[model samples]
Each structure stands twice: as C-alpha cells, then as structure tokens.
Target chain A: MNWKRLAPPLAVLVLWQAGSTAGLIPGFKLPSPLQVLGGLADLALRGMPPGHRLHVHVLYSLERVLWGYGLAVLVAVPLGILMGWSRRVRDWIEPLVEILRPIPPLAWIPIAILWFGIGIRSAAFIIFLGAFFPVLLNTVSGVRSIDPLLIEAAQMLNAGRRFIFLKVLLPGSVPSILTGMRIGIGIGWMSLVAAEFTGVRQGYGLGYMIMTARDIQRPDEILAGMLVIGLIGLGIDGGLRLAERRLVRWR
Target chain B: MALHLEIEAIQKVYPSESPEGRVEVFHRIDLSVDPGQFVSIVGPSGCGKTTLLRIVAGLEARTSGRILLDGRESEERDRRIGMVFQDYALFPWRTAVRNIEIGLEIQGMPQQKRRSLAMKYVRVFGLEGFADKYPKELSGGMKQRVAIARTLVANPEVVLMDEPFGSLDSQTRNRLQDFLLRIWRERKDTILFVTHNVDEAVYLSDRIAVLSPRPAAVCGIFDVALERPRDRTGPEANRIRKEILELLHRPHTSPVTF
Candidate 1:
C-alpha cells in the first residue's frame, strides 16, 4: 500500500535487470532478477534434484527450527527465572554460561556431529546452541529489571512465594522474554541453514538446495534459494513482532 | 474488621561507605493508629516516612521493631495489612478488575467469587467502564484507583499508603483524596498514610504525625478535630497546615531513641 517503500527495491531490480541484459553482470556469477524468478518456478514445479521440491525443503527447515527453538525456550526460561530470582543459582551457573556463550553455534557443528551424528539431532543441537543464550539472558534481564516496588507491593498484598514467582515475576519478565525469543529464533534460523550446508541426511533443506545449485553451476537457483531464505526469515520475524504486540499491548 | 496498628521502637540502619560505615535512617520511630482511624505521617523529603511505611507493611526489614496488629506482634508479612504506593504499582499486564483481584487470588479465593467481588469494587470505585483496561491505558488517577481497589478488595485491616497521590496533578490529587475519604467512611479500615503535602495531611487525617529530618523520629503529633467534608482552605485546615510546615522547616535535633 505504501508506494514509497516499494519504489527503491523496484528501482534496484530494474537496474540489476538492465545490467544483466547488457552483459555488464555475468549470468554465472550473478543471475538477473528474471533468471532468479525462473529458478524459483523451476524449484516449485520441477524440484531441486528432480524429486526434492522447494516446499519440502521449506517444511524440513521449519521443522528443524521449531524443534530447536522450542527446546531452547523450554530449558532457558525456567533456568533464567531461577538464575534471576536466586543469587546462589546465578553465581553457580553464570560462569558456565559466560564460558560457553561466546562459542559460535556453527563452530559446534563438528562436535555436534560427533555427539548426535549427521541426522536432524545434530542440526537441532546446533540450532539449540544458537537459540539458548539469547532466550536465557533476555529472560534473566527481564526478571531482574522488574520494578522492586512491584514485588514489594505484591508482598504487602500477602502474595506467597509461589504467587510472586508465577504472577509477579513471570508476567513482569514477559516483554524481555519475548524480545529474547525473537532474537533466538533469528539466530536459530540462521544456524539451521548454515548447519544444513555441511550435510543433511534427508537431502531436503534450503541450505542443501543452495549448495546443490552451486555444485550444478546454477547461479540463478542459488540466488533464488538465498532470496527464499531471506523472505522466510522476514516472515518469521514479522510473526514474532505480531505476537509481541498482542502480548504487550499495555506497552 | 479494622485493627489498631502500633509501630514501636522501629529502627532502620543501612550499611554505608561513609567514615561511620553505617547510616541510621531512623531509630525509635514510634506511632500508633486507632482502629478505623486515618493517620498521616508528614515530614520533609528523605525523612524516612516511606521507609517507615515499608517497615510497617513488612516490605522492608527493620533493624529492630515490633509492628502490632490488634495487640499481636504481626508476622513478617501480615495478611491483615496491604499497601498502596506512590507509583500505583499496578501490574501493567493485568486489566483493572484483574489487578483488583490479585490479593484475593493470592488468598486462594475461587475465581468466580473473586471476579464478582472485584467487580463490586470496580463499580464502587467508579471504574465501571474501564474495568477491562490495562494500567497503561488508564489515566494517572484511574491507575491509583485500581491500586487502591486492589489493596482494598482483600479487606486488609491495616492499609499503609506511602505517598499514594504524590505523582498526580493538584486537581487529580484533590479528587482522589475525596474519593479515598469516601471509601474510608464506607469501609472504616485503619489507614496509615504518608505524604509530604501538609495540606493533604491536614485535610485527610484524623491525626498527623510530623517526622523530623533524617535519623527521623516523630517530632510532633497533632489531632485535627475537624468534621467530615471539611473545607480545604478553612481556618482550621490552614492553621494545622501552617503548624505542620513550621515543624518540618525547624532545624533537626538528635532523635530521642526509646
């Protein structure tokens, strides 16, 4: 609906198309926008390796992300709350977290393959490593940043320990937790794609399709796959932002 | 049922980085509120009026003190006591009626029963249409009303208010003051209100306890013998306000600890 937003991208695409048609940009190194569109149509209709369709690749990638991100949330949120609420827990766990968090998730690929093998488990583990710290740290900061007066007010209202944790602490930290989730998902999605680039037993992933396109010397398909990955990331982030708006309408 | 509240020999000391290595915020701060009485603690800013209220509410630990509710030494966090804060302290995530229901929910009241009871207060507080609105959506006055309603729905025998109307504009403050008086008249809950506003203290309290500056003690206690719906600018109210102001402005003397 906003023409202003559409105009810049349109202009770039037109310039790119013109450059490709004039041979200023080589096809094998960089495909034109039209060639990328043709590649996309080929992926949807004819599949990447004859039988592995684009939709199947998308579904597999989504499944991996969901599994990894879900597990990260389940483990991180509770741990974060405990770490935030108890000084002893924080003191014990913070050092381990600090030591591990700096290691890139992609760097864990070889170790993860050794541990879980070349299946979905290794990929999920890599994605989990990518997602976990953001969720945990955000949740911790969220809980810690809550107004002490709110806790005091809850105490004055005779809220017991459980009530304070569930009602006051949990709800208070939601905004931060959501922000963490958004960041975690972004990183997890990226890690999943990169993890798939090494190898996938299922032969179905956006990253695998891109790698195969490179092997077959189809720059157009590679560009098309990259665009798909970016669009999916945008969609995932947009979905999270919508959920955040609903959850924190008070903000 | 309202309970008499006694704050006896309350002391608060904070470890400090100064040469003394400790700061005594207040010591031997003693005050008492009769059953169904409205008492205000007025003092200069930073005189520990809020700290005193926090101690009474059992939200802060005192170095040494006893808070007696109806002659019994209350527990660390007495269910019979509740507090309203200057910032309202309403759960921003909760709607008005839900915020009002928080204490009841903590008491393990049945959901339907608590909802109906909270609705009654929503109507009583004239927050009828705004019952489903979150604190952020409400005006400053409405948020305070929700905070007050939240505390009152649980029917706390002793209500500790620490500058509950401090953040509002003068007009909203006056309106809320009147609204609070109306609620007090209806409920007759024992209230210990803290404020820096001398006029507010005079206009609302049955008794005003003036605290001296830091390491504070009750410097003076004045009974406001004014009748209900008393004029804010009346001779009696003005006279009491002026006396309290003068007491606040006086140079601090070493507090006498009992």
Candidate 2:
C-alpha cells in the first residue's frame, strides 16, 4: 500500500482543483491537476507545436547531462586522486580548486555560453562546472582517508608503489567516489535547467519547454515539464542506488 | 628456511609537546633470536613493542640503530619478513584467496600459479569453505586466520606478530595460540610475537623478552623450556609468567600507568 505514498500529493491535488473550481484560486495562474495531465498527453502526441515529442525533450536533456557529468568524472577523478596521493600536486592545485569551488554553476552561465555558444556544448559546460567540485573533493578525501595500515601491509608484502595505487587506493576510494557521483548528478541536472534557459536552435528540452510555456502563460505545460524532469531525476538516482549496492557490498 | 634476526639497540623518539623537546620511546634495546625460535616481547602499554616489531619488518624506521634479517641489513632484505598487525589489517575488498594472492601478485607470478598458491594457503588455514568469502563476511577469529594465511602465503621465513590474538575472546585466544604454534612448527618459521598478556607470552614463546618502562630496553629474557602443547595453568607456567610480570612491573621513576 504505497498508495500511502501518494496520499499527501493526492490530497494537495484535490485541494488545488477544488480551490480553482470554487474561484478561490486564479484558474489561469494555477492549472488543475487534470489540466496538467491533459497537457502532458497533448504534448506527447502533437509534439508542442514545433513537432518535437515529449521523448525528444527528455533525450535532449538526458544527453546533455550525460556528456557534462561524464566529462566532469573523466577530469575530476584523476585530478582528485593525484591531489590526494601527492602533496606536491595538492599544493599546486588545491588553492586554485578552493578559489573556484564557491562560485555557483549558474554564475558561470554567461561565460560558458560565450565560450561554447548557445548550444549543447554551452549547456554541457555549465553542467560540468556544477558536477566537478563535489566529485573532486569527495574523491580526494576518500583517497586521503585510506587506512595507512593497509598500505603498509601491501608494502611489507613487497608491493610496488604502482601496485598499491591500483589495488589498494583505487578500491578503497570507490565508495566515496560513488557518493560524489550521486550528489554531482543532481547538481548537474539543476545546472542543465539554468543552461537550457539560454535556449538552443531546433532543440526541445524539458527545461526549454518549461521556459517557453512560462513565457506563453501556459502553467499546465510548465507543470507537466516539471513532472517529467522530476521523474527522470528519480529514475537516474534510483539506478545509481542500485549500482551503489553492488559496488559497496563490502561495507 | 627459518630466519634469524638481530635487533641492534633500536630506538624511537617523538617530538614532544611538553618542556622536553623530544620523547625517546626506547633506546639501546638489544635482542637476538635464533632461526625457528618463537620469541615474545611483553611490557607495559606505550613501551614501543609495536614500534620495535615494525622496525624489524621494515614498516617503520628506528631513530637509531638497525635490524638484521638473516645476516642481511633490513633494506637489502627481500619480502622475507611478514607482519601481522594487531588490527589484523585484512583488506575488506579482497576475498580470502585474493588477499593471499597479494604477495604473489608482487612477484609477478602467473595468474594460474597465483590462484593455486593462494588456494593452498586457504586450505592450510582451514579456510576451505570460506576461501571466496570477503574479509567482512568472516568472523574475527576467521579474519585473523585469513590475515595469518595471507602472510604465510608470502612464504617469509620470519613473521612478526603484534598481539595477533589480543582482540579475541579468551577461548579464541587459546585456540589461535595453539594454531599459531602448529603453523610455526610445520612451517619452521621464526616468530617475533609482541603482546601485553603474561600468560600468552608464557604459553607460546620459546623465550619472553621483558622490557622496562617507557623508553624501554630489554630488562630480562626468560626461556620457557616447557613441553609442547604447554599447559596454560601449570605451576611452571605461572612461575615463569610471574617472573616475567615482575620484570615488566618494576617500580617506575616516572608516573607512567601500565
């Protein structure tokens, strides 16, 4: 009876619908739940006037997140590990990372769009900025916190520096790295929303859909877009959880 | 292939927080163990037994003096010394067999040979059914057994054990003591066991090295000379245990608690 899980939302929907019908709520400003659902169905079929389906918007948003998040991982993990493993590297890079870290992803939007220009590249660059630090910091701390005893044991067993790095350090930092990924993905999704507000030619993304619908005063379409964005985020996070279960089974 | 060790006046010092600019752990600590001998060092806490063991295994550097493993200087020695830390220090991510495979991995042994060698120790340690199990899945005693097996797989002539059974229950402690004795007898290994327990020292060691207080030195060395499967509750066991305890419990000039 996870219908209990739906109880609060259902109650809120009912209240909103009743309030709108009773003229307690401005009807156009806050659409009914049924109107939002109907809007979602219409968007699924006729494709939002530009002939782009709901699936097309989802794909565009999903691909942007994947590219940006992927690049962040590719760059950050190695950099983080190097910083953690070597004091020299950390001293060289840490101050720079700290300076850059406090700046929010949205603040970088104008410069990102300037560099990559109003397309998937600009959106992905913004998302990369969003995802980078959490992943990097967590990974660095993970490597730094590895038990010195384990490394000593490996050394006594005649393990070389490279062997210790691969066998001990890599596996030890995995759980923390996964934690970084989960957090980074959420921030990356949020950054994509802001990035998409800049718009792309011939592009249909849930964020772009919400922005245009807002300009046209279609609250129903905006709500539908929000619902889809939330559902996609939930699905991705759920998948990450499943992967986490396997990776950190030892813990 | 038992190995002999000569610990020549090993010492350690830490930078002090107090008025004394430095704290010497132990200095002029001299002891020698013949090949295949089982020696245990017992003392008050913070007497630096673990540090001495680490120095012997080349895990830590002594502030002064040196260690000789089978006539070779510590640095020149290969992976001939194995150390079993008090925490057991088994890698959580590795299976019992995989943990044993680590030493072989360092030697760049072929995969098939590594697996077979690891499986051999897995069976030797009676980890047959649990060979594939990760360290988290094993019980404390079993984890220690796996830790021992992992070290044994390295085929070191000398193994330094830092309170190998210190964390176990009394029954488990007694069981592991006998198990360790059996491994030493069968493998013909020289074991430098460090512990705080007098009974454990008297029960397992061929000789017990008693250290004085902080910045400790080998104050006395007592030979067990007891029979195999030594009685833990025997009169001689108590007598020697008491003698070692007395050596360890000498009145301290400083206000150090044991």
Candidate 3:
C-alpha cells in the first residue's frame, strides 16, 4: 500500500533489465525478464511435458500445501493452547518438541518416502511437519502473551473454565494464531519443492517439472518454473496479509 | 433490593522483613453497612483501604473473619454486586454499550433486554453518542461514565467503588462527583466507596470512615451532616472537608491485633 516501501523491488527490476540490455549476463546463464516471460507463456499455453500445463504443476504443489497446512492447523492450534495454558503439558512435550523442531522438515524426506512410498501422501507428510512447528510455537507464544488482567476480569465475571478458554483465550490469541499460520504456510510451501523432488508419480508438480527441465537442459524453462514458484509464494503471502488486516481490526 | 452488610473481625497480614518479619495490614476490622446507606472509607495510601474493599468484594480472602450479606455469611453467592475500578477496567475490545451489558450477557439475559437496560444508563450518563465507541476512543471522564453505566446496568444491590475518580482531572472529577451524588440520591443502594481524597470523601459520603495508616484500623466514623447536592466550592462543604482532613491527618497509635 505504501509506494515508498515498494521502491526496492522496482529498482531491482530496473537493474535486472539494464544488466540484460547491457549484455552483462552471459545469455546461457542469465535470461532477461522478457525471455523468462516468453518461456513462461510458452509453458503456460503449450504443455510443459506430457499434457501438463504450468498451471497444473502449480495446482499440484498447491493441493499438497493446502492439505498439509490444514491438518497442521487442526492439530497444532489446540495442542499449542494446551501446552501454553498448563504447565504439566508444557513440561511433558517441550523437550520433545525442542529436539525435533531444529531438524529441518526436509530431513524427514527419507522416512516419508519409506512410509508412504513416492506419492502425494509422502509429500503431504513432509509439508505437514514443515507447517506444524511454526503454528504450534507461535500459538503458544500468543497465549502466553495475553494480559493477566484480562484473565482476572474474566474470572471476576464468573466465567467457567470452558467459557474462558473459548471466549477469552481463543479470541485473545487470534492475532498470534494467524501470525503462526502465515509463517507455517510459507514454510510448508517452501518444503513442498523438496518433498516433490523425491520419486513422485502420475503427476507433474512445479518441483518435478523444474527438475525435469534441468535434466533436459532447458534453462529458460527451469527459470520460468522458478519464477512461477516465487509468484505463487508472493500471492499466498499477500492473501494472508489481506486476511490479517481484516480480522485483526481491534489490534 | 437492599443489602444488610456485615464484616466480622477481618484481619489481614503481609509477610515483611522486620524484627517481627511480618506486618499486620488490617486488624480484626469490624464494620457494617445498613441497607441503602452510602458509606465511604477514607485513609492514607498503603492503609489497606483497597484491601478491605477487595475482601468485601470476595476478590480476596480475609485472614480470619466473616462477611454476611443479608444475614447470611458471604460464601460464593453472586450477591448482585457491582464494582467500578479506578482504572475503568473496561474490556478494550468491547464498545461502551457492550461493556455496560457484559454482566447481563454473562447472566444470559436476552440481547434485546440487555441492550434496553444498557441504553437507559447510556442515556442517563450522556454517553448515547459514544455507545458504540470502544474505551480507547473515549476520554478519561467519558470512560468513567461508561464504567458507572456498566456497573449500574446490573441494578446491583451494593456498588463498590475503589477511588473511581482518582485518575481524572479536577474539573472532570468534580463533574463526575456531582453526577455520582445525583445517582446515589436517586438510587440510594448500599455504596461503599474507598478514597484517599478528604474533600471527595466529605462531599459524596453520608458517613465517612477514617482508617489509620499501614496496619489499618478504623480510627473513627464521621457523619457528613452537610446538606445534599453539596457543591465542592460551597462554604458548608469546605468546612466539612477541613474537618475530615483534620481527622485523617491526626497521628493515632493503638495496639492492633495481627
């Protein structure tokens, strides 16, 4: 919304265009924006590989992210709230989560392939791990940050434990929960590329197509695939920002 | 509804690091408010005035004592109590009207009935224009008005205020005092107001209870006896204020039970 904030990206684009025009980049190594767009148009209209349009590749990755991120939210949010609200739960799980969280989601790829065997399910599992930690950790932080006075006020108003949890704790932690979900979605999206790079079958995801293009020596197609990934990632992030602005009207 | 209140020998002590390693805050304090009588507690800071009020409100427990409301001991009964906090303590997320209706909503009152009741107080306090506005949107005095309206919406039997106007400017405080006096006169429910301001104590109270410092004990209770609608700048009010201030300033020593 602020033009001044957007100047960096505009300047980078201008520099890239200038560098390409001045022949600073070797043609085989670096394609101009126009060349990338032309290759992108070709990939979008004509099939990238075996009846798979670039849009289909994007949709394949998107489907995996949605399922994984959705499941992560369903499981992690309540667990995070429980861990935050009670000391016993936190003590029991905190150590396990701490040790596991530092391990990148990609590190689980071998186990995921062994368990689910080179399919969408394997990809979804890796994406789930990517999303889960961010949402869970952020949700816990959010609940802990709530003001004690608000809790006292709810207590004085004769709110029961259930009512307080639902009405006070949940709404109070919403902004933080949303923040966690946004971070989780982004991480999950990033993890999907690696997840799809494994032995996926019956479909071409953006990750799969990028690898295939690299093998076939179509660097332009590889660049186009990377551009699509960046654009889609940016779009998802923008959607979250819009939702955050609308939902956190109080904040 | 009327409240026949009783406080039977309430004692409070806090741990300290002196020769005794403990200090008595309040000592076997006994007081009672008759049905519909407005009693005000005046004392210096750190005198456990607010502690005493909290004990009565059931927000805190006494060291050893009993509080009876209408002849029965105050247990976990909801007693139709109202509280106006010094900081206004309105929920930041709720609008003025919503804040006023919060107690009713908790009681599961229907939305229309709650709104109707909340609207009456909103109109009475000249807060109709700001009914839909949040606490942050209102000025200090306006927020206090909303707080009073919020308390009054429940039609509470006993309204406990802890320095309700302590944070406001002098002009707003005076205006709110006059407004409070009018509300008390009209409603006449049992009101226990705790304040450190001597002028405010005499101006609004039917009877002023002066409390001692630190290990708080009630030194004495003085009947205001000044005329109603007592103007802050009026001669009678000034005389009463000076008398109350003199009582508050007196150095008294008595052996208080821990």
- All models, DockQ values? 0.84, 0.76, 0.42
Whole-model Cα lDDT of every candidate shown, in order: 0.93, 0.87, 0.84
**Best candidate, DockQ-wise?**
1
Reference-based lDDT, residue A70, model 3 = 90
Off by over 4 Å in 1: B254-258
Q: List per-candidate RMSD values in Å.
A: 2.6, 2.2, 3.1
Among residues 3 or more apart in sequence or in different chains, the pairs in candidate 1 whose N, CA or C atoms overlap within 3 Å are none
Report the C-alpha lDDT of model 3 over B1-258, residue by residue, as the tens digit: 768778788999877898998889998788888888888998889899989988887777678888877878856734566678888877776789988887788778999999998988899998979998878899999999988877777777888899999999999999999999888788888899999988888788888888888778888888877778777778877877787778778877665779
Off by over 4 Å in 3: A1-8, B16-21, B77-79, B251-258
Candidate 1 interface RMS = 0.9
Q: Taking the tens digit of each residue's C-alpha lDDT, what string does model 2 give over A1-251?
A: 68889999889989998988888987588888888998798678866645878899889998999999999999999898888899999999999998999999999989987888888888889899999999999999999999999999898898888999989998999999999999999999988987888887656787888888888777888888889888888988889999999988888
Candidate 2 docking quality: incorrect, acceptable, medium or high? medium
lDDT tens per residue, model 2, B1-258? 888888987878888996999998886899998899999999899888888888788877678887887777855434788888889898888888888888888889998999998998888788899988888898889999988988888888788999989999999888888888888888778889999999999999999999887878888999999999988899999999878777777686667779
Q: Give TM per candidate.
A: 0.96, 0.96, 0.91
Model 3, span A1-251: residue lDDT tens: 79999999889878887898899976578777777878788779875674688888888888888888899999999999998898899999899999999999999999888898887888889889999999999999988888866665555555567867887778778899999999999999999997887757866798998887777767778899998898898999999989998887766
lDDT, candidate 1, equals 0.93
Better of 2 and 3 by DockQ: 2
Error of 2 at A88 (Å): 1.5
Identify the candidate with maximal lDDT. 1
